[model samples]
Target: MTHTYKINGMTCDGCRTKVENALNTIEGVQATVTLNPMEATITMEKHVPTEELQDALSAAGNYTIQMTLPPSHDGHHHQPH
Candidate 1:
């Protein structure tokens, strides 16, 4: 599954890398972090709790992450009703 989240406390490209590296450390999770939008698009093998993500972020730095609306980049396309 794929999920995007709003990431806070990033100030530069290094911060961006830190956040990305931190998130990617998780098992079966791949995250792409952007500084402009300050968000992380995470692809996971299973549904991982937000708390687990938070834990990893905390270890990397004083960063916080939360769901971005919900499945904004979950690789799903829907036809117009």
Candidate 2:
């Protein structure tokens, strides 16, 4: 399933990459993040707990979720983070 999350504190491409990389590091996630829109789209291969994803983003020290993207909209690619 693919999940989208509205995130905060991603100011630059580097910040975006960090969050993206962290999310990608998870066992089941394939993450893509946009800095302009401040969001991360995560594709999972298995059942990944939402709390786990949130914690990893939190550990990056600059991300907060505004809203979570539902699975039904995986193809709705938006603008920058």
Candidate 3:
């Protein structure tokens, strides 16, 4: 499913690219980030929790990501850490 998230701490295109790359690191995830509104639209093959996404973003930069909307479906949830 595709999910939208609000991203914070991006200051420029470079920062946007970094966040995008970081999010892409996770398995089965593809992310696109836009700086104007500081948001990301992510496509996932499986359920991935926000914390895992945060870990990837933290490693790349000081960015933070949170869901813009509650998940569409809670089914097939991946185990959380």
lDDT of 2 by residue, 1-81 (tens): 877878788888888888888888889789899987778888898878777887898888767754463556577667798
Q: How much lDDT does each candidate structure score?
A: 0.93, 0.80, 0.93
Off by over 4 Å in 3: 70-81
CA shift at 7, candidate 2, in angstroms?
1.0
Count of clashes in candidate 3: 0
Using TM-score as the measure, which candidate wins?
Answer: 1
lDDT accuracy of residue 55 in candidate 1: 97
Model 1, position 4: C-alpha lDDT score: 86
Residue 8 local lDDT, model 1: 94
Work out the TM-score per prediction: 0.84, 0.73, 0.83
Off by over 4 Å in 1: 70-81
Model 3: what TM-score? 0.83
Query: Which ten-residue region of model 2 has the weakest summed lDDT?
Result: 65-74
Per-residue C-alpha lDDT of model 1 across residues 1-81, encoded as one tens digit per residue:
889899999999999999999999999999999998999999999999999999999999999999876444767877799
